[model samples]
Every structure is written in C-alpha cells, then in structure tokens.
Target: MSDSGPVLPWLVIRQDDNGNRYRVGRYATEDEAQKIADSLHARGRHEQLYVVERISQPAL
Candidate 1:
C-alpha cells in the first residue's frame, strides 16, 4: 500500500449475476484499474459487474 513499493496492489474484479467473482487483473494505480474495469464492463454482458479494489501486498 505504500508508494515506495513497486508492487501493483489495485485489482480489477468482475462479478456475475450468480455472485461468482473473478480477478480481471492488477494495476499500479486506482484510476488505471478503474479504467480497465470500466472498459471490460462496457463490452461484457449486462448481467455482469466490474469493480476496482485496493489490496495490501502480502508479506514476504
């Protein structure tokens, strides 16, 4: 979550009407992630939904 890290913690998630979820991809910035999600949602089925979320990097 820190700006100093090179990790991409922003996630683009897709969820279906059935409540099933899948990870679309990851991005370095929230805006980037949201844009990807929006693009997917625009072209995908109407019953599906796209969202952006920030995730913490796992401790190594």
Candidate 2:
C-alpha cells in the first residue's frame, strides 16, 4: 500500500455453510460486487455477501 502502485482489489465473496469461502470475483467498486451478489441471491443462493480488500500483488 505504501508503494503506491494501485489500490488493492476488492473481493466479493461469501462463506458457505461448510465454512468455505466462495471466491465470487474482484471488482473496482463495492456496488459492482453487490450487483453480482444480488443476482446470485435472486436465484436462491442465500449467504451473506461482503467486500474485502486484498493485496494486488501476485503471490509467490
């Protein structure tokens, strides 16, 4: 974050009943993420959706 390359990406996901996090997708804005979650919910996937800031750097 201190290096100032680009702001970290936001992750939109939900934890399943089995304690597994469903990696929905990354978005530039929370609203975009929520739209995806809402669409999924309309189809009957009931789980809490949230946005998480993640490091943009690739994992080594």
lDDT of 1 by residue, 1-60 (tens): 467757788999999999999998989999999999989988999999999999986685
- Quantify how close model 1 is to the true structure by its C-alpha RMSD in Å: 3.5
Screening candidate 1 with a backbone cut-off below 3 angstroms (N, C-alpha, C), the clashing residue pairs are none
Write down the lDDT of every candidate, Cα atoms only. 0.90, 0.64
Question: On residues 1-60, what C-alpha lDDT tens digit does candidate 2 reach at each position?
Answer: 457564437677776667787787777676666777677766755555443545365665
> Highest TM-score, which number?
1
Give TM-scores for every candidate, taking all chains together and pairing residue i with residue i: 0.82, 0.55
Q: Please report how far candidate 2 places residue 5 from its true position, in Å.
A: 9.7
Question: Which runs in model 2 stand beyond 4 Å of their true positions?
Answer: 1-8, 46-60
Best by lDDT: 1
